[model samples]
Target: MAAIELRNIVKVFSDKRRGRDLLTLDNINLDIEANDFVCLLGPSGCGKSTLLNIIAGFEQATSGRTLVDGKQVERPGSDRGVVFQQPTLMPWLTAIDNIAFHLKLKGVAKAERYDRAMESIDLVGLRGFEHHHPSEMSGGMNQRVGIARALLMNPSVILMDEPFAALDAQTKLEMQEELVAIWQKRRSTIVFVTHSVDEALVLGNKIVVMTKRPGRIREAVNFDLPRPRDITSPEFNDAKRHILSLIREESTRLAQAS
Candidate 1:
């Protein structure tokens, strides 16, 4: 069975003032196999995050099923870890504490919690900053903590919504590299939401493109480029060109319609 399954998923939001329901996701059907790093890429307002939220069980869909591990997802569960655009760490807690907070909640002993959390800390390359508060850490470091927190959970799937969007270009690139390394090491199924074509091309082995609002899947491109991909290589540029053409064509069609 697919690790994650979206069957005819649909979402509608009520615009109370406008007094009409706004269709946000028309019918999104997708299947993400285990250990797959899938990127949901599209223009802004294309329901990429909305669809991701549905899978995360943070929002209920108007119709259809969201399943993970062959079971229907009804509510947020620890089985799926989420990393938001912001780290969303506690401003006061140290990095180690924040990463192991869930364990603390489960009544795990302090020593054990720290031990488990440290493994994640190492996994995300945040070892020396264990006691640093979110405020003391750089944006990239905080993001690493967020990723560590998620990994500490040993979740079956990791859902990220533009998690690297806030960092500077250099930091963003570094974080992307670390993420791919972590994913390879852990073999976790990941569903990432983003609007940047470059980010998607750089990170995903499977890129799923969506059309504008009331989103629909445009295509699910399989990318098998070798590891440590060269962004300037012919193969990489060829794939980039293909994806760009698809987006441009869609944009042109939409513009003409408007």
Candidate 2:
């Protein structure tokens, strides 16, 4: 069975001032297979994040259906984990503590929580800094903690919304490499949302490009480029050029409509 299935999904929001409802997602349908790293890439305001949120069960669609693991998604559940653009860790909690907070909330024994948290900490390459608080760490380190926290849940799916967007260029590259490695090792289904063409190409095995609001699927480009991909290589540039052309065409269409 598909890991996730979205059939004819639609989302609408009320515009009180205008006295009209605005459609955000329009008849969207997608099937994400297990262990697939899919990136939703598009221009700003394309409702990519909204689509991710619906799948995460943070929001419900106005029409159609969403299923994860062949089960209907009603509300937020432990089966899925989310990592946001900012590392929303508690400032006072140590890295290990922050990663294990969910377990603690569930009344897990301290020893077991620490043990599990340690594994994720090492997974994100923050073993030695486990005792450091969020304030003591760099932006990248805090984001690593966030990723570890989510991974520690062992959720079937991980939803990331531009998690590395706030980091410096070098740090972003490092996090991206580490994230891909973790995904390879963990082999969990991931739906990542991003605006960068290169970022989408570098990370996703499948890139789902969306049209501007009211968002619609433009294409689902399969990208199986080898890891540690040579960005300057012809194959890489060729893929980038293809996506660029798609974006350009989308822009031209919108321009003409306006």
Specify the highest-TM-score model's number: 1
Predict model 2's lDDT versus the native: 0.94
lDDT of 1: 0.94
Model 1 residue-pair collision total: 0
Worst 10 residues of 2 by lDDT: 76-85
What's model 2's lDDT at 59? Answer: 96
lDDT of 2 by residue, 1-258 (tens): 899999999999889999999999999999999999999999889999999999999999999999999999999987899998899998889999999999999999999999989999889999899999999999999999999999998999999999988899998998899999999998999999999999999999999999998999999999999888888999899999999999999999989999
Cα distance off (Å), candidate 1, residue 46: 0.6
**TM-score (all chains, Cα) for each model:** 0.98, 0.97
Error of 1 at 24 (Å): 0.6
After superposition, the stretches of candidate 2 with alpha carbons farther than 4 Å from their true spots are none
Worst 10 residues of 1 by lDDT: 118-127
lDDT of each: 0.94, 0.94
